[model samples]
Target: MIVVVGITVGILDVCELGSHFILMSITIACGMLSEAYARGPPAPNASTHHSERQIPFAACDIAQLLIALCWGITGDIAEIVSRARIAQLWAATGVAVAYMSIARWLGNVIIFDRKKSRFVANAVYGLAFVPYATSWCALIARFALAINGAEASVPDWIIAIVIGMFFGFTGTFPIIHALSINRVIDVDAAEVAYAIAGVANKSLLGWYMWYGVNRMQTA
Candidate 1:
């Protein structure tokens, strides 16, 4: 299924979509690593506790950083665009880590009571995506522009909000699915939904950034 999705997305445009997928993969990996770390190590019984194997968080984080660097290098090669400096890239990564940490914290606090209607529950979860995506877009755009020596504009914020809402709406799919399956919503469940939705959403966002945003810039 992932391969099929990747092939379809790659067909749209390789460099942009590929870069987006790489970044999303890194984020997802980090999330999973963090979760595993929180869960602790597996028991000595290898057969019974097979699912408990986990990579160290520090190792996963370093690997994710390297992946980002490689993606930047690939983007530069494919697009003939200047890559962000290593320092800038590191800064952006720090921002991302901080953002995810906050989002997770927020998810923990904001409970979606199962007693509420699905519409209400979904709406609550959907609303969270607005700010989450918006801030992410804004930070990335701002940093990219700054690194490229371009002036930031008001439209950047507007564009971020538009894209954020798009992601938010699309992101509701997993949450709705989870709700239907479990008849309730919780932080962990919602986080899983968000992670799942992220794969698809980021793919679409990649295409948008490549075709739509890039075209607008050239025009």
Candidate 2:
């Protein structure tokens, strides 16, 4: 739950810029380390252990699992942040539903699994920012809320643009695993690109989150 840890750390005194960057670098390093390990020669499958041990990563893999766990924790932290914006939640949900509807139609009408690559599925999953969009979706909802005596904040266009890119890159996370996409990773150095993108997205979201919080507080 590195995410949970990160988010927890974020809430714990708002994380000064330097400390936050340091922790974020650690997070990226975790991803890189995990990638390096996965790229190492694949070990033979051991069937002796129960629980359908397809690939032994239990005790053998410490860093990867720890990172995963920490990320989960960060999600918990984000949820805490989100709970403060119920109006944004509703607004983001609406946005997601509407956006997905149109996306589904487009997917069906065109680009409907032309190649049908598993990697593509994973990449699409990486792009899908279901809840994270709330950071901006809430902003949109705030504007809408003002329509009829509803208290809301001004829609900051700058933050929306920034967060949109962040959310877009956040989606590419899964496919970034160099080990997972061997061919593309080898040819395109996509893993490195993904690593860079991941950090960028996180930083962008961080700014968006902090900006929103700061503005709302002062508003």
lDDT of each: 0.37, 0.35
Q: Which segments of model 1 are wrong by more than 4 Å?
A: 12-120, 159-200, 203-219
Query: TM per model?
Result: 0.29, 0.29
lDDT of 1 by residue, 10-121 (tens): 3332233345435544444454444445555445564422222221224343344334333432332222124335433432343234323322222222221112243244
Q: Which stretches of candidate 2 lie above 4 Å from their native place?
A: 1-13, 17-22, 34-40, 44-117, 125-136, 139-219
lDDT of 2 by residue, 1-219 (tens): 333433443443132334433544444444444444444533356233321222222332333333433343233233323534432233222222222222222232122222234324433454445445445444433333333233322333333334434433554443444333565333222322332333344434333433332332233
RMSD of each: 17.0, 18.1
